[model samples]
Target: MDESLLSIMEVREDLMVSPIGDSEPALRSAYFLKPIAKSLDGPVSKVLSSSMTMSLPPVFEPKDWPLVIHFDWRRHTKKKWVEWVDALQLRYKSVWKKVGIFEAIMSIKCSIAKDQNLCFGIAEKWCAETNTLLFPWGEATITLEDVMVLGGYPVVGDPVFAPLQSHEMREAEKKLILAREQLWRRTKAKASLSAWMDAFVNSGSEVEHEAFLATWLSMIGFSSKGLVSTLVFPIAVHLARGNPIALGPAVLASIYKDLTLLKNSIVGMTKQLVLGDKLELEVTLQSPFYLVQIWVWERFKNLQPQPRLINHEDPMMFRWHKVKALKIDNVRLALESAMEHFCWRPYVQYAGKFKVFYPENETLVLIDTDLDKEPTGLLVSFATCLRVSLLVGIQSTIKKYLPHRVAMQFGMDQDVPSCLPRFDGTKDFAWKNYCRPISDRSLYFPARLFEGDITTRYAKWWKRSLMGHQDFAKNMGHQDFAKNIVRRKRSPRSPQVSKANKNGNVDDDSNARKRNSDVDAPSGFLLKRLKTVSSGNSAQDGTIANESIDAYVPTCKNLSNPSSSASTAEYENVKRISPLTKLLAKDTVEPLMGRLEEDFEDANGSKESRLSSERVSLSGTQGESYTF
Candidate 1:
């Protein structure tokens, strides 16, 4: 505990913030990322480089793949080799940029393979062929049964929930619960109307009460089109004359029908990516704050982003695949295979990233209503509540695990760690910075958390016993760490002079830039590895079977002669992935077997990645640098 916190008074639970507790009204909740900034003179930039290009395997038609031949690696000429390499590299860059690089290159390769393989394409056919199995995507009203079955339970194999759950809604919402008001009760029903009419009610600013009026004074009629005051004016006039007998019930009933139906119309998109078919869901699970922030995807398109870095209109879809069917070690490999063939769009119109996360709170709550599909197309409940505990728990956890001194930075705040500079001063130059705003440059931490698209260790190890399946990926791994990058410092001298005197080649001219000759390589490539790609052919089982191995000897001039520079990994250093792996050509590791017998081959021959302190030169407008 912090020394300053010992002087505190009594602490109490916040009733308004609890989703599972009795609060005034049901609330809506979703996760979002908040932009933070850091100072950047020391570890200003992170680099991912490759000395050579690795070719992206071609995406074949899934149906066509089963008929194609898996040729040996000896048929192509030198020219063909170059063409293939260029094509593959281009594919890697374009695809990562297009869909967003959240996983290893190996997994991406696997996805591309699956998209082309016919066997994995069954979901689309199933969704289209059988009406009974499809999530009711085109509906206006959901049966109460559907909501109970899919959403009522917090845990299930293929669970989905939509609209408001019966028990979660406010009791006054009985107008909408025509099927059975007996299922749930409204709290203080009699006092609710009295308080609603009187101006003395302590509503505490609930979102549901935002639309409710406290008084009926505007009887002459308001000009607003969507206001209930105008629509219910006739009921007001009758009540005003002391004849408030029963019109409110009918009016509320009509509103109820619309509210229930309206909630179901705005749906959350869910799709199955072959990681595992079963989609387990949770409603308002209280979790680590960073977990939510890291899961959200941010974009730079907002010309004027809100100060808090939140977007209420933006929809986020988190797609986590469960592959308990495979060996525990093959998770990365299985994911690589899935991405090799094609990309999966879990939420097409949304700014969401797809990857995986193991569940932390994965228990089942059985509303146990046994209907398969809701008539209103709602397969799951709408998220209407957010539980942000502004208590010491969140504060301490973030402080300890993702210490504020080293947490993700967005360049908006002062006193933050150094913000990462542009690769070439272009805001969108790096994949992480793509589509990010020019002014919103920030350095995020633990690639798994801040990337907004990569999966975390929790998903990899959550509920392992329950999964009862082996890892799906046997042959996948991360690209070799980039090494030998040339990170430089800001010097008064020009690039020409700086290279000559302090840091230079044995054969350098005096005009070359002089660097501090006493600096060691900034840091070795050290990041949570969730990426995979090799400059090789597609393996038989729809995953990359071999890690791309690149061998390159750096010229003496680029080598650093360190005297006393602190290692980047120990301090504030970011890793630079050299486009190379240290694996040999002769080694071959087979992956977990697929349900169907498939062809397999060893893909090889790659590029080298050099890691060094990355030297970043501001390429665009050099505005005043902003910090935490």
Candidate 2:
């Protein structure tokens, strides 16, 4: 037999026949026959014994058991042993098959785990051994490689037992702690100065770079704490190399202290100045800045029984009066000319009232109230007169022909009367005097009163003209009744006219009548003659006979005649009036001149040509005289 078989038979013989198996003679004898047979095969038996000893039983079973004892030894001991040999062979084949399958499974797990960087390969080997020897199928297997993979690292193979450097690991741990500390410090600093820090941190270029870092960290399962440290390291190195972790915290703390100091200072100053009953020192020290200056000045002027200590001559205290006038003589000439040109009789009566003077300042004031009792019409006439006078006054002043600077200085101080007032106060003398009772204490005294009976005569004339009434009753010897009602003249006993006469000179009635009648009769004749001549062919004959007569005759008469002779003569006169009127009308003068030029051009070639012809005709007729 083979050496391994001989050793196996010897071990089987020893275990199959125990000393207690003497009663079983055949079994004992069979067990002794195998060892005796193995002794006879000397060299083979030794080699077989060594080889068989090296062979172990299934890891899960005892190696000392006899094959015969496990099977039936009584029946055909020799055949039974052969059968046991076949069964053992079958068991070895099955064990080999299971081991092969286990090894194949382990190989597959290792290949897969390596590719996937998983720990299952190591675990599979352990699992096979555990299944065979310990728990069999009771528990699953795990490996150190599996643990490493689960903890988020790649496992190469079985974990080798090696010593780790304690100092180096501790140093790594300190680095991580310092990184975390620096990261927290930077985060706090950024939050502390978030408003100003956004200017740098939120830059487009930096944000994109930071975003890439954040994504890379995420792929490795790094937390934000780790990423903050990694990203802020370079910034800390550049800004604060030594003790980088403390740099950001220190900066933030210092900034906070500065802000607190500023806030406290502002609060302290505000408490001292704004929350007190006393006048602010700054305002109290500056006299011009004080409110009392305005109050004192106002009281000094307005308080009754003024103290002698207050200077009356102070320019601030003196109220300058400015009186403006529309010269009556000039205004009368303008209105008369307008009436004559319109071919309308003058319905307005003038009272020979002239000369206005401010008693307080000796300032002369002249105004035109030429339109009888019609206030609006008088206002319109006054406005026209004022406009012309203003233009002339401005031109003359610019030429230094009038005291314009003095007038302007006075105007600056004079407070113009308001169009309306809340109450009849001292400022509103007209309203107070007109509306309030004379006996009332609040009645205002006029700065200057209008004297003479001009307004009374105008009011009567206006009533007559507007109502289309005649003076027949007054002429019919019922003068008293006519004056009392139709003319609205005062009753004989009323004191208004008596007072006026007392205050000023009363005109002689006979002299006034004589003067009015003479003037009226002559003016009526001249106007009638002008109208008739202007409407007839007389103007044409008159123009030919002597063109010089055109200059003396009114411009209205010349304009009425349609003949070229009359147009040419009228154009000349209008041109002469143009430059003078321009100086008086300012802005309106330009448009008027343009119209004149256009009219002259349309009539003849141009204004210059028409004027030349008229001038020649006038010069030629200068030696002759013509009757109107």
Candidate 3:
């Protein structure tokens, strides 16, 4: 057996049961007594015949009933009869009470055992005697079956009963639910935003190109009335260069729809270009922002009536001013005026310069030359306007010959400048005096207008203005008069005295008088010439010749006996020679006129050379005069 079971058995054996004093012997005798009354039975006969029989405990013989414990019924009958009646009642009540007590004890034992096994088992099984133990009086009786039903098996004792707050538990549950909900929402939103941003950024190049195309189309609506194939061709070129294919279908659809409507006259020409065309057509569907801008502008045009120009003179004069101001009805006429007036045809031709073609509208579409088609048509920085202006002449000439009423509808005013000089001078002069006005509110116009020659002139004028003086002398290159004056200052002596002295034939008085006379002559005089080309039908070329070669030839009489006058005369000849002759003279004169050539070369080398020579001469010979 298991050790625990053995221990339980030992405990059960050790339990001592004690009996009541009066009932102890009787109970013992009853338990020990064995009856032995056999008469001629088969077992007694066998025992009598047996030679030897084992001795056994004495069996009790049958006893004639000896009434030792008896009640005095006869003697006390009369007295007891009366008492018997009372006693009988008392005995009946006692028996019933004892039975009830036993039942109560049993009930209490059962109830305690069911609810608490340790207490009930200790009281019932460990007691000295049944009568010695007492249970509470009037305790509610519960049957063994009822107690068993109420208590199943007792649970093992627990030590901790930690209470949790209702509010805290609820809050924990709520937080979990909210966290899950927020995470789900954020995940979904992030995905959506990511998709939108991808589409937006990816569409950038297409959007830019489309915006340019729309601008071109709007400009083209002004002049001619043809589905100009050239204007629409660049779109195909743009697509061929590996632009995203997503924009293709939509752009083609838009073009087809607009062209269809335009062919059918379902919408007016201006409306067709601006609103209906854009919304229905998909040109570079890549950029939502650019597409939206084009759509908005188109819708703005759609709400207006067709633009009409009353003036017939200048086709350049668009009626945009009136359209911008008017507000009756939900009409916007500014776009219509732009479509009617702006020359879009030139843009088409402009695109042609870079090998791009677009469809032609009523007006010329002016392509900006600066725009590059690859990598999204970015304008080449410096070459745009020249190309755009080249096509403007063609558009202008076409507009000039259109019918007056049609021209008036286009708002063309023929008030061009009659004299090119006046126009050039006025425009340049006005630009010089006042800052150039913005052309059509575009930021790029000022840069385009004053480029190249105009820019150079403007810079010169600006420098002059800042310096506070204009260079008024017309022929600033001429230095003959200045050179002559310089020579005169250096030589205040007569050439004749030098010549006579060289031949040893000069008288002092005559030489002095000649020298005085030479000093009195004027130092120099400036001669000015003005040349003008006549503006006449006869194309004549003019040439003027002033051959004065004798004046430049130097004489030996002037050179051999040198004086300040002879040196001055040689210097004057040098200055009068053309730069070509001076260059040639450097080689030829060196051999022919040795010292005189050296003197002339020294004077003519350069300002720096002259200054250096002067400094050397002053340092080397303080007061002496050396003439060549």
lDDT of each: 0.18, 0.18, 0.19
Report model 2's TM-score to 2 decimal places: 0.13
Task: Flag regions of model 2 displaced more than 4 Å.
Answer: 1-507, 521-576, 579-628
Residues 196-235 of candidate 2 have per-residue lDDT tens digits of 1222233443232222222222212222211232433232
**Cα error, candidate 3, residue 322 (Å):** 24
Residues 558-627, model 3: lDDT tens digits: 2111232323223222211111100101111111110010001111111111111121120112442222
lDDT of 3: 0.19
Tens-digit lDDT track of model 1 for 1-628: 2221111111111111111111121111111222122222233211111100111112323232222212111111223223322333442444322221112111111101111122121111121101111111110111111122211211111111112333434332333222112212333222222223222223232322212211211110111111123223222222222221211112112222222222122111122222333443322111111111111111111110111111221111111111111112322223233322111111111112111110111101111122232211111211100000010111111100111111112100111212222223321122112111111111111111111110111112212211222221111122111111122321111111101112222213221212222221222211121111122321112111232211111111111122313332221221111111111121212111000001111110001111122221111123322110
TM-score: which is higher, 1 or 2?
1
What is the lDDT for 550 in model 3? 30
- Span of 10 residues, lowest total lDDT, candidate 3: 25-34
Question: Which clashing pairs does model 2 show?
Answer: 3-48
The segments of candidate 3 whose C-alpha lies over 4 angstroms from its true place after superposition are 1-186, 194-246, 252-346, 356-628
